[model samples]
Target: MTPMLLVMVAIGGTDILFALDSIPAIFGLTQNVYLVFTATAFSLLGLRQLYFLIDGLLDRLIYLSYGLAAILGFIGVKLVLHALHENNVPFINNGQPVDVVEIGTGVSLAVIIGVLAVTVLASLTSARGKAQNAVAAARRHAAEYLDMAKDPIRRADIFGKLLAEQAKIRALPEKYRAQIREEQELMALLHRAHAEHGSTSAR
Candidate 1:
């Protein structure tokens, strides 16, 4: 199959897996079937909007993966504790319910929200995150400038953004700046964009 078809297939498979994985989390939060159905439906429907909303900010959210992992881990532990509390196995805890603390839904929601808030705050404030965002934005703007080379007006705007990002990168720590310079592909893209912009300006 074509590359685009392959990409579509891969994305479809991933979405299916994501949906399946989320079902447990939904049930863990609430057992109401109607709520679960609506939640799943809306999540699926909002996937496109969600993608657009975070596409530019994804690189900036450096701690997002860690936060998500923490959330999932907390939920997993909560589920296990819940299972232990309702234990009915013949050999496990003598088939009696264990006296374990079950996490309340309200507490779980608060922890999830709090963890997300802190994660976003930390990511946006860290020096490393700032450097990474600058590098990513510069790279993206350079590519966009190249793609819009024929459109002088649009290219001008993108080039301006690219230069701004480059300035940010330069103002970063020497180590971070060195890392960006070491990226040969990115450097090449930036150089080509600059050359094209200069040529266009002279015309």
Candidate 2:
């Protein structure tokens, strides 16, 4: 969709084609204009809300583009099959309609929902695992430097390196951060204790 249009352009020209097909389909089922208007209105309203819910999931679904293309292709093939079944072209099928199976609304909806659920679940699971690994790796890095040396200057050097690394890391769970900070504070106290001892022994 275009971010903005110089003119209205009939909802970017696509709406016009959809309207042509939908209007006839609704009219074939019902002549009541009011019923048609309400049906279309509610459908659009529901779809708008569904789009919001699915928007964030777009990035997570790595195969979204492929999935949508597959769906559109399936619908195109079905339309082609339906057309051939009722085809009236004299040369093509001798003006006779052939029998063909149609996809039901229930089956279509179920398949769509199943695909979406699988993708979303897989994405969320992958994200969680990555986050856990990141946090674990950060903690390991911090712990490695924490107990490396007992010399005050060396310990402070290690602590400074950890601080620098911490700044580069992404957002983590608060509890993990708190634990790190607590260890850092403990290390600071140890440094101060060593400093005090050095001063007293010099006296």
Candidate 3:
């Protein structure tokens, strides 16, 4: 078989699996053949678009498969319960023969909606948190570089004023602060000597 044919087969097979669970869940709703056909066809028509939508959000949609699997599994369970309820076997305790399908379908629909809401909320929260963290990190790194640049002389003095205007972004404790101060002092001493030698040469 050609590669394209194989791909088509795989996609079709997956849709069939999704339908196996969903069809039964729908049947559990209205036993009418026409309504089931109409509903299933309409749903399947829109379902194809989901693949393209998911492709656009490949990495960000990590939890999508999990959500889909859970929904499918729920439908499968409902089908099994419905089948068991219909079975009038004597071995089974003759507890009230309840029509489990409608109850199962209602419960499954609610769970699917709840899961989607939580997933969307969590994704938005995490994205906002990450963006804030990145902005803060960039500001901190900028401050560190400015501090490093402000060393040694008259030319460096301009940078010193800029650093003072901006509050220290890094909250290094006493020990590191003391070390940076010492480095600044050494740079000042070197500049002072250079200035004195230049002045003497002018004389």
Candidate 4:
């Protein structure tokens, strides 16, 4: 398949998985069908805008996966606990409800919010996050510069951003810098962008 087609397929698959995962999580939070439907609708509608808003900062959020995992785990545990509390299976709890403490909605909300807050703070403040952000920014800007080669004004702006990211990468410690898997490729791309920009300006 073509690259565009592949991208479309990947996006469609991701959306499907997201809907499947999120609906159950929402149900875990509350069994209110109306609220779940509205929440899912709004999330799907706003997902594109949300992605664009945070696109540049995504690489900086190194701890985001961990936070999401924690949240999902919490929700799973809560669901299990609620199921046990309402259990009626003859084999389990002797056909009676398990007296396990169920997590409240307020507490669940607070825990989710707290985990998100801490994850963002840690990702933004950590050295590794900074390194990853710088590398990602450099790559993004380099690609932008090349794609906007016809637009001198925008190309120059992108080149400027690329240069700033390059500086950040240089300032990082050797240990962190060494972690860049494609440093040579990135540098070559940057050099090509610079050469192209110079040639365009000279014209």
lDDT winner: 1
Ranking 1 against 4 by lDDT, winner: 1
> For model 3, how does the per-residue alpha-carbon lDDT over 1-203 read when each residue is reduced to its tens digit?
79999998888777666666467757755568998887777666665668866664433444556666776677667666776777676666575455554345556668878877766556445543333333333333334433443343633453344344223313444454354456564335435544543554386
Candidate 2: global Cα-lDDT? Answer: 0.55
Which residue ranges in model 3 land beyond 4 Å of their true spot?
1-18, 25-31, 43-48, 94-107, 127-203
lDDT of each: 0.86, 0.55, 0.55, 0.85
lDDT of model 2, residue 50: 59
User: Best to worst by TM-score, what's the order?
Assistant: 1, 4, 3, 2
Error of model 4, residue 119, in angstroms: 1.1
Model 2 alpha-carbon miss at residue 107, Å: 2.1
Give the alpha carbon lDDT tens digit for every residue of 97-157 in model 2: 7677765555555665676676556544554433433444445445655455457676556
Residues 43-96 of candidate 1: C-alpha lDDT, one tens digit per residue: 766664666667776788989999989999999999899999999997999999
Model 4 lDDT per residue over 1-203, tens place: 68999998887676666666699779767989999998887776666566666776577899999999999999999999999999999999899999999999899899999999999989888998889889888888988889884677878788888889988988998898787745788878888888987888798
Top TM-score hit = 1
lDDT of model 4, residue 122: 92
Pairs of residues at least 3 apart in sequence or in different chains that clash in candidate 1: none
lDDT of 2 at 200: 41
